[model samples]
Target chain A: MLNTEALAGVRYRENDVRVFEELVRRYDRKLYNVALRLTGNPDEAKDLAQEALLRAYRGFSRFQLGTSFEKWLFRIASNLYIDRLRKQRNVRFESLDEPVPTASGQVEKALPDWSNNPEDVAEQNELADEIQAALQSLPINYRLAVILYDLEGFSYEEISGILRCSIGTVRSRIHRGRRLLREKLAPYVKPAAAAGARW
Target chain B: MTCEKAMSLMSAYLDKELGFDEFRQVELHLAYCEACSQEYESLKATKELLGTLRAADLPREFWPELRERLGAVAAEERVAPARAKFASSARQSSSRQPRWRGILRPASGGGGGSLFSSPMAKALVPAFLVLVLAALPMVWSTRRRPAEAQVSSRIDSIEPYFRDYVISEYDRPLSDKTSVGFVVTGQAVTMYTSDLLGPSSKVTRASGLREASPLPPNTAGNEYTLISYPR
Candidate 1:
């Protein structure tokens, strides 16, 4: 069972390591989901999610009581992801920790890497890959708004705070982003359906 | 409402961001308008398709690894003076001003003076002072330097009028020529030599070379100094 109060209590510890672990256990999945949608790389998303959690833990004393912990956590994740993207200046998803494995089972030497894990379920894998490819094809701003709203289920207001845009602008970006995504998925989606896949 | 108008606002309406009257209008139109309804459904379907794109989960080992890395970092942070250094600076800053301004307020009022009245106003005062103190020298220099083009234009216009005049020759007994200097007394003594000296470094005219010397008592002897200094 998830007890946010207990988690909050743990997070409030001056420097208690166990409390931080519990905090990590609580939001790791959700943050990972949001990061994956934003970045569209499993390894980068994992690292980014971890980074967000670690940052939150470091600054946990600032967390407001009686408000949505999830929202606060989400804000941290979204901000970190946006900052990382800005710093990279058009580069995407090359993890410092893990690299693409080559023929000799050694990591490939490259700047911005695009690699897929072979272990995921095939249909889920296809959906994930197509989603990533389609996401990358969209403009970065549109991609951020759409991912924050539809996939991660952030409200327009929350997304505005996270993306630092007016609610009206956030709505329009999500709408336009969805339109472009639908057009991009049309070809890939129809072929998959024709092969008897439901998604 | 027409399909275009309804379609245009469907995104806002779906997001529940429409103003009350706009929302009502959309609801009323959607009750009877099949075309608009179909368009809304299509847009809704598009959103659903988008929702299928999920963030990939990290491996089971990933969090543990991150925890280890962060633990090491936290341990290092514990021993390092970086936090202490920041805290000391923060203490000095806070001591210099009030502390309540750091707290979050619902409405940070636009009446600028009210910000200082804030409980945290003391802290903000020091921070603000620090910023101003840091900026003062830069601001002073920026204000002190005359605009280059304006000075250049003034020089260009003033130069031609006086370029022809010169002391024909300093012919006299050395004592008489030395005694020929005037002793003009006024607040401003040393003038810009460039005003009289042409760009070629020749003293073409000395119109404002005081009829009487304004030279102070310490340097009352030599009066032939016409050095050009930059503005």
Candidate 2:
């Protein structure tokens, strides 16, 4: 356990720059990952991570020592990502009633080539690609919960803090997200005979 | 518990957050239910597979910029207290030292006109009192000198005669008629539980003497030191 009392005393009273530097260095990578998964873009993740660090630095004085600094920092980063997403309200997804839009609503949707041409199907090689596509297509909230719990290994409590939701919601999102991924990946799951093919 | 309820708690059960009773309920349900067990396994595997996504560390220089920003913020915090102190000191010098105006006038350029203007000067009265509090001990000692000396002289003169008598009187049981003696010094009154042959004492309370009888009530600033009493 991080010595919250000592860290807080040093941070508030000593105003220790090195401690603050260590804090940023410690959380920056995790924060970047969170931002990356949330924004679904590297450049935006980097910007958001830097912004979160700055915000955390500004607000460090008010941070309660001995509590979850990780949660606090993630909350800041998550809120920033949510704010950015809110600002970009034009991010349109395929509504339940609408056809799946490819790249743009006007672009003709490309179906997966399944001619059993061997070269086109590529056996299990397309599984990873499909999973990634399905993940990108997930609603932002479900995607966030899936990434945080599945990829980041955040406890449900930590995810709740990061997502500003109850743990029940986090569990529901994860369960729903996985169910959706399994559904989307259904066609791609190769049969035992088909699995023998070379990539 | 039904499988539905048990499933609702699986996450908490996995995390060991469920209470013992709930844990028992979930455990009993899980033992009987295969479908829920399969769902739990899938959820656990998905959690594991998700955990495999390594967080990509940014370039080495990224944290440096963040640290630099943090350092700047920390430096700002360090300077805040000193800045506040300086501001207060400047405010003090402006009000107390008329001669400081000459120095401030040239510096202020045109902002000096409102320095001594209404409301601000009135506010200076409280600030001036605070500055004077630095010499509070001296003020209290000077005011208390005469009464303190009288008490000391009375103690000295009365000591020789009361030596054995004071000792015998202290032997008289702790009672209401004990007649605790006190000397009024400035705004304070000094009292002793018995009197000198023991140690000097002070009994203070904020409510004047309303409760200053032999028995003391809960009050602020009421403290006693045994002056001197018989052995």
Best by DockQ: 2
Off by over 4 Å in 1: A1-15, A61-67, A90-124, A188-199, B1-4, B15-20, B31-35, B81-231
**C-alpha lDDT score of every prediction, in listed order:** 0.64, 0.64
Task: Give per-model TM-scores.
Answer: 0.51, 0.51
Task: Kindly list the per-residue Cα lDDT of model 1 for residues B61-177, writing each as its tens digit.
Answer: 876788787777667656666678888999898777655554433346665544445668768878989999999999997885576445445655544333321132222233222
DockQ, cand. 1: 0.15
Q: Over the stretch A1-199, how does candidate 1's per-residue lDDT look in tens digits? A: 3455666666323565666676557667767877777776778888888888788777766877666667777788878887887899876656666766878787746565355754456555786677777887878789888777777777888888766689888878887877687788765433221211212
User: Is model 2 an incorrect, acceptable, medium or high docking prediction?
Assistant: incorrect
